[model samples]
Target: MIQTDGAFGRPTRHAPPLLNARHAEDYWQQATRCIDLVRRKMASVDRPFTGAHPEELKRLFEGIDLDAPLGELRPALEELERVYLDDAVYFHHPRYVAHLNCPIVLPGILAEAILAPINSSLDTFDQSAGGTFIEQSLIDWTANRIGLGQDADGVFTSGGTQSNLMALMIARDHYGAALADHGDNKHEGLPADYRRLRILGSEVSHFSLQKSAAILGLGYQAVMPVACDDHFRMDPAALKARLEECLAMSLIPIAVVATAGTTDFGSIDPLEEIAALCRAHGIWLHVDAAYGGGLLCSRRYRHRLAGIEHADSVTVDYHKTFFQPVSCSAFLVRRRSDLRHVTHHADYLNPLCQAEAGTPDQVNKSLQTTKRFDALKLWLTLRIMGADALGEMFERVIDLAGEAHDELARHPAFEVLLDPPMSTLVFRYRPADLCETELDELNAYVRAALSRNGEAVIAATRVDDKRYLKFTLLNPDTRLEDLTAIVERIVHHGRAWCEAQAPTRAAAS
Candidate 1:
């Protein structure tokens, strides 16, 4: 016979009531202590990368015995809590501007903490009944945004990288269906008529396309990068010339990748021109709108991504511009049938007939068998905030970027590179008397020093081989003050570094 504690039964020895009483008391005490620690840690404002009391961690795990008793475990756990609680960079703090990651909404974070551990996997209906439906709903919602009609299909991928890979997979299979039947002679030996597959994109297209090329059995050499115009948009004439060259070389131009918004400068490529070129060439057109897709929400800025509707497929990373947390990304296709190219059969899992019937099996449409229902966060965000609210948020950020451009230009010590086409402003830290080389080095040093000191987080990139600092204003919480403050710090630090180098330059001279 098992004795219970009025809740559930644990395997017990023939121990006395006092022993169990001590165990329950000990658990409550440790839990209360942990809760208090959490509360205090969150309430503190320093946002320290390392906690104040690092040495106290040594005592945390030293005296604990796991097998002794539940009562005996409290002291050890208290130590464990002390060691690991408050040593992370607080992204929620307004200064975190390094990458495209967004500060998560409070409700979304709460939903993730609760639902993630409960309904863990979204691979099949049995494992994630409601979760599968929710993910599908989000996919359908995104498809509608692309004007894909009822026959459209999409899948939530890990991020922009995986989405680009999936797009390549669909394009490759659609162009090379013979490989599905015979596993491709190249897998065993090169075929006599093996023609190189070519992909064309602006030089500023995301590096993910190169990675996608490598993964799709096409070498990086196979991906041809066409030149972009002065504003970094792809030039259709350049792309047409490259396509003509590829044709003359007898290379199969498999896909044309257009950038709706580039990574470095947020420069939108000539999408309408590229789309028309792709149609003329009978090539698959994929618009990599990962950064610019959020412009879909803004009527004022939507014209920037014109001809996106003509894309055979498009990739969108909601985390970058939509302010959705990371991994809420997808690839949208013009036709649902294109996804059939990535389909496969497993005897134990999705059988032939079930997939053929299209019973809403996400695995059939994805490269990943076991996927996360990352779409829930987006769904919940939309349901609560509505599309207009998110769109307005995007517009506000773009508006702020414009303001930043004007202000940075007005500052005597700074040189704003170009008008922020989207939300990214690329600029150099130009001091009053610094030469070209000195100014460039000073700016670079400032960026490195700020990142090292953890005072602020900003991005650095190269355009035409010259390094420039970039501000990607993805966070709606980030204000004009935040941008100006960081720019001021960069100027101050850059000037200091340049002054310090003056004596060295004189000595060398």
Candidate 2:
């Protein structure tokens, strides 16, 4: 059924779709109104954002009474449109190349419609039933895609942050178990020399690893930063040196976290070499493939994650690259037994008796007790649109990044970073006359000016304490011309800012 509210707000049904059959029609009618609100909003959206400031939106909500209800769905939606939807950032727009967020597929949205109404919680078999199996099936499929062997197992997670945290927790427990002085930190508490435990990651790796270190009771100090190469990949030589240094200092190197894709540069670590280093030291290997994990869907780019199969644990965020909605991600492990670290037998929930009966209790190996059936979105998406089709789409974005990087390098006024291993480009405007300090200010001003005018949305980051702009090209619909137009706007704003500062420069001279 095509969902539409069109130019009219008339009810399309007379009943609700859940619980009572009597109100089924009403539910579809109300659902259509909400769907059409989004449909109209996206269809009409010409810019990535509305340039609405915080104070402007705050004024819109200040006069509203939260206690009072509109008593009708239409009015409530109308109020939402005015306060939220109107000013909300449209990630689906082609110019929205700021973050890793992707334009979701229709199949995933349809899955959301079915899953939301039923609201199946995947904590236990009784609650989720078929949902548990569907999630497990997808986990198996993802494991196979990663070339993880038969013993591989995993559970769905909220996103990459939680997944990375889970990986580190398992690493901590697994490593702690082998130590003579440290034993079972999960239940027995941290060992006396827990301060000696260390986790190594690239300098360019996700911040989640440090956050995970803090959460694991190892303190942020436990994280050792390994240096990266010029292109921003974890240098294997640097990692080997760090490992030897840790051993020389009598510190316990618990794990090596290799980033498959660095956040800013889209650089993949030399995973094959890194895996070899982890194997040599018998250290737990955890690959944070959150951004590049989508390559698993691409037949052409699958080899980019060559050594991911060697990881003890891996974090993949479907929301980032798989084109799934938020809260859809998974944490995979090479050995099913490694999950014993995260397992807990709650008598009221997933009891030991259930395990004895050979029941699949997902909560036994999950960080979350109450979890949504997010796997359904992936399952339905794969079923309707084959993995090959999705892989082709991912390939397009990867190809687009290479083209943009080369084109950007030819631009005299801008400094484009190295070609991305995936679909991201880091560049900055550098006018000939400005000093290094002034270049930073000019690029930052351009980013803000574009957003201020609602012309285009671009992201900014700092490389070596110098400001730079970045393009995260996740949307396949975003073409070269669209990016070229954004570049024109950037140059426009940069020149304008320079001209406005001419008076100040003259006064300083």
Candidate 3:
């Protein structure tokens, strides 16, 4: 009832052939065509987004038939280019100050090209070979940069979210192991008093910590939020007070998740102070440096993360700050043996005997088994552009942020948040004629309108229940003038929307 293609179209006993050398030429041609289109799009100084509305996209996608392949490479590529590539948001554009996305370096792109064809699964030495070593080397390099001792070790993860999850998992297991007669939480679920186990994090910390607690059976209530200071950094005094309160209530504080770079405010918590507090309380310190990790190589800004070295574990997202592609992040621990908390031996994948016999398997440490070789992207980036070059780029963005902050502060139409600790600037357009409620609505409307028009892509967030726009300046080449234009456009839209609402508000009043 089935048919298999044979050589010269003759029937044969063999099954359908897998893609190998026989398809290499065709594959190369198709891949290069896609790459060429991407290169052109990246180079173009056009709108950051296509501003395609949801209804329009729904209508467009309805025409696509998924049951049958296009068969011809050229037609498929043309269709993709028309439907997707044309509407794709271009982070490399100078006006795109939207999120944590970065303009990837050339070496990272080239590394992707190489890795796609090889398709190496970086779980075991037998499968990855040199890939295992490369990933290990990167981990070692990152740990050393953090001043994590020689016993330090880590594994590449999907991104910051997964890295944070893995860090909390390790902390939970380590804490559980210390409890009376509770060996491993992985083998045995949390003890009967799991409700008392809690994770302490700043109010501004990423939401992943709470998610991790929920996933680890600790419940979202297990995460206690510590207050932050005037500058949005976690207040060490508040953290100490919370820890004492937890102790007084007979609650077990398993870990202190200090944020090196928070998402909205770009606030770097007082790492040195937090590290000392965690040390005194004997709490595991996991620093989520997903955004600020680039400061590791930044000669000028590296001091901002001075006490990161004291962390028990650190989450670094190279994709966010190192100009690498997505999914290039690692969760590092101070002691190599601590990673054993996540290890499991499988006869088919990694056997205990093979590990004992000196075989290096990355899966032993990672939450993921068949992981992508994302380390190669950062490796190639560092090799092609020296660490200092990357650092310089980071410095440029930080400097740009400072300039933009001053410019926004001077503008009467905008109310800038605390001076940026990193490259993100959070501000809201406050028109003189509008009240607090009206200003919030106006700012929110401005963000949506700009996105719908696709003139300049920016980010928006709420601070203290009031809407504020955020400019995440990750592009080193993004200048003050570009940001000024974006701000002007935001103001323009805010004013227009407010004026339009005036008649309706008067009628309602």
Candidate 4:
């Protein structure tokens, strides 16, 4: 029980300050202990998430209270240490091969810890004078990478989803000029004379684009998915056909979204060919390079993203491929004027003088006003590690994925899909004497077993109406041996499941 001064058996003083000196000291000591524990954990951890122990977690949070005193929290804190700090899967661990989240370099995290507490808003120059310069510098660097000229401008977004949404907003406002001033016109219903607007992208284009279309009053049907070739790339010929059909229907092609690297497979569409189509059709070209933007670091791989220069806008997620922490993404445009489509003003929030002073006011370009200074994390990442090192890390993950694919293909128990275009590998466990249906069932079993055992966390997706396990290689520390071990576990579990079901399967057969 906490000791408190009382008058007439009632607490005389107000409740203890939330963070008094004693509590602060206690927290500091606990934090120090946590740091030491983390260092020790990091040394031994390989795959943190999948390798996590769940029973440990249940016990940790069993009866923790929200309003508990600091002294009372000691037990819960100890419990948290027992489960999360000790048993949780560490992405920093070499064996973690689950989600798209990368093991962020320490420098980036350190910068965030400092900068976030200060809470600098990048919305305007008055709010973030030096921060504006930092953000612009990073945008310029990214623009140059996309082959957008020196005149190009951009702003850091929350992530790829925000970037994609901004791209659609610009495209829609440009094509449907009247709609910009009259969003209410949609409720009034699209004008009888309004030209039919459409967005074209590969079938595998990020789902965010469809949502963007819906938000813009274009309806989900406004997005037309073009055909993809065997490589899962947007087939230029098919896209041309779709555009021609739209033209025949008197529908205006507002924007053509070409994926630099798709989410499932790292497939790069034929960008140069698609760029030509956009030029000829006079439609906006927005490259969703959210997944493959890191390829800019690889001289050899950079060529795959050709025609990015011809694009009007591009969305790149630095967090995805650049090893930055989450929410660091940028949306860039070839011409700065296009940003005017989204520009808004209010006298109270952004006075005319501040706007007219020629300040680097990011609010004029951003969708949000009170934006966090997300640029510092990227800035610190580039400064401490340099672009070359970061690029090498990007290359390393892709190389590891390629190597794992080949090794998995050679193993008789596993069937690898066609080679990865970039880094993601799609494959499944195979058992002897199994038909196509049985094989699919066994693969499903393997995936479930991996999840239940908490030995490794892997993702699964369907291609061509068939399911396969997927590993999106984002962690540089994940090695070939680690993948091999995962495969072995998958096979072990799959074989056991198959054997257990053997009698029933035979009867059905």
Candidate 5:
């Protein structure tokens, strides 16, 4: 409780002053202790989750005074532990192969330690002097990696979703500009037939494309999903057909969105062939490489994303593949001039004269203002550990996926899907005695049981209305032995469920 200096017992809302030169020692002591608390918790953690039920946890936070302070950092942090840290999901655990979350590298953490205290905002040159230039350098380097050529330029975004949205937004305005004679399409708003403008994406592409279309005044239906081949990759022939159909129906194809790495299947579309189709149709080609962009660092697997250089725009999530922390992603364009669509000038912020005077205000490059110094994390990651080291870590996981796939296919009780083009594996448990109907329930039970026990955690998804399990292998430290143990636990729980149901079935029969 805060010390009450008032004459009465009434509580005061204020506790402490803000950090400044006088508070340097206080900040140092508090920050160190807080970081140590997390370090100890993380190091001592055994499982990915604590299996804490939602309702049970919600009760802990049921009633708290809105205006109250513990008056000390230690007490507040201790309270936070009870509600959050104690039961928080630790993605660093090798058994937590449920989603795209990756364990961060040490250099990224070190960079965060520095950036948090400085609190630099990257919106303008005056705000973040060296920060703006640092970000520009990283963007240029990433564009070079993607082979986007000399005219390439981009800006850091929150994540894949924001990056994809910006890419689609640019595609929309760029097409609208060409359609008109002489005017800024963005200022005049979407074209007269904006409803008819469609974006073609692979059937297995990220759902963010549809969300982006909806946000850009086009309905969700504006995103037309083309067919995929048996390998779960976008069929180039199918894409060609869709493009021709768009012309026949008098529907303008604003962009052809090809996925370099799909979410569930990890299958890469035929980028070169799709680029050809986009070129012939005079459509903007945007590649959503959020999952597979790490391939740029690998000389071995870089060929997989060969034709990405031809893309008019691309999205890459460094947090996902490069082992950086969350909210580190970039949206790159082939031509630097294309970024003018999202550029907005304000006298108080980035005025037109600032750009003319060659002052680098990142607000002109991004749709967002007051963005974080997320680029610093990536910058430090590359500086401390070279790109090759990150690539090797990524390569290890991809190799493990191939080995895991082969083992799952050979195993009698599991049904493995296509071989991953990157590092995610989609599969489900299937006993020979069970049919599809029983298998769905069993797989769902297995996933839930593992999660409830707090031993291992995995993912579940639906494939064409058919429920299946998934293993998104992003941890380099996750050995086959660990996967074997997870598989065994899944089998044990599934068999238990089946045995319990057997008595009911026999009695009914």
Candidate 6:
């Protein structure tokens, strides 16, 4: 409770005020204690997760009052440790190979500590003077690395989804204006023929493109899915045929979205070929390299994204492959002028006069007004670990995936899919006696069983209507032996499920 009758009418609260000199020690001590608890928890990474059920979690949290304080910091942190930290999924653990979540580097963690206390918003220059420059510098560095031209500019976004959204939004407005006799879509509504506008992408491209179309008022129907080859990469010839068909039908092509790294198979599309097609069609090319953009620094695998420089815009999520924490991603454009489509100046935040006077405000280029200082995390990471060191870590994980792929291929019970283009391996359990339907059920059962036991964590996806298991190797510490053991555990669960099903099948028959 706050007492309003204090000196100078300042409220006297149970919690210390931000600049209260008397309670400074108390604040420092409590923060240090929390940090210590985190360090201990991180060090003890024996289990990937506690496998807490939904009902159990609901029971544990149901009694807590959101508005009420728990009192002392020690008791509060202890309660958090018991109810949240203990049961939370540990991505740093070697067995946790389920998603694109990467084990964060030390410097990134340190940056979080620093940024949280300061609480600087990177939106306006007045709010974050040096912060704006730092973020812009990081974006410029990333743009240069991508080989985007001198006019390349970008803004840090919350994640890849937002970046993808911004990219499509820019593309839509750019082409829509041309179609509407150079009218502004922001001032005037989308052209009357917006229904015929279409964006092209591979069938395996991220679903964000479809969502972007819907958000842009183009409707989800406006997205045209191109065919992918056997390797799960976009087929250039098929894309060409589709473009020709669209032209014949008088459908306007807005943008061509190419996936540099798809989620399930980690496949890299034919970027150079796709760029050529987009160039010929005079359409905007946006590459969603959220998962594969880290390869820009990878000494050994940089050639995989050879034609990314030709992209009109690109989305890169550092959290996915650059060993950074979540919410660190950027939307980069080849020409800085393209971003003006999304810029709307407000009198209060970033006035048009201020921008014209050469003031650099981040909100002018971002969809978000109050943005986090996420670039600091990447800055600290680069300074401490170096780009080459990060690249080597990525290389290790990619190599581990190859080794795991080979092991799965040689194993008698497992059927390995295509060799990984990056660091994801898709495979499934297959017994000689069981049919395809039974095998699918067995593999799904195996995944559930492993998840329930909390021994290992992996992912599952469907390819060509068939269920398959996936191991997304983003943890650099995860070794070939650990992957092999996880595969063995999966096999064990699969065999047990198959045996249990045999008697039931016989009875049914």
Off by over 4 Å in 3: 1-18, 507-509
- State the lDDT at 53 in candidate 6: 83
Candidate 1 displacement at residue 57 in angstroms:
14
Candidate with better TM-score, 1 vs 6:
6
lDDT comparison, 1 vs 3, better candidate: 3
lDDT of 5 by residue, 328-401 (tens): 99999999999999998999999999899999999998989998999999999898899999999999999999
- The residue pairs in collision within model 6 are none
Residue 210 error for model 3, in Å?
1.3
Q: Give the Cα error of residue 410 in candidate 4, in Å.
A: 2.5
Clashes of 3: 0
Task: Assess candidate 5 and give its TM-score to the true structure.
Answer: 0.96
TM-score of 1: 0.85
* lDDT digits (tens) for residues 129-227 of candidate 6: 898999999999999999998999999999989999999999989986776375778988888888999999999899898888999998899999999
Candidate 5: residue 186 Cα off by (Å): 2.1
Task: Give all candidate RMSDs, comma-separated.
Answer: 5.4, 3.9, 2.7, 4.4, 2.9, 2.7
Q: What do the candidate models score in CA lDDT, each in turn?
A: 0.76, 0.90, 0.88, 0.80, 0.88, 0.89
Q: Tell me the TM-score of each prediction against the true structure.
A: 0.85, 0.96, 0.96, 0.88, 0.96, 0.96
Q: Is candidate 4 or candidate 6 better by lDDT?
A: 6
Q: Judge candidate 4 at residue 57 and give its lDDT.
A: 60
Error of 3 at 282 (Å): 0.8
lDDT of 5 at 42: 94
Cα lDDT tens digits, model 2, 1-509, are 43434213333454222344555666777788889999999899999998888999999998699887565677889899999999999889999889888999988999999999899999999999999999999999999999889999999999999999999999989877777876687778877878999999999888998899998898899999999999899989999999999989999999999998888988999989999999999999999999999999888999999999999999999888889888799999999999999899989998999999999999988999999999999999999998887888889999999999888899999898787889999999988889889998999899998898998888889999999999999998999998999999998999999999999999998
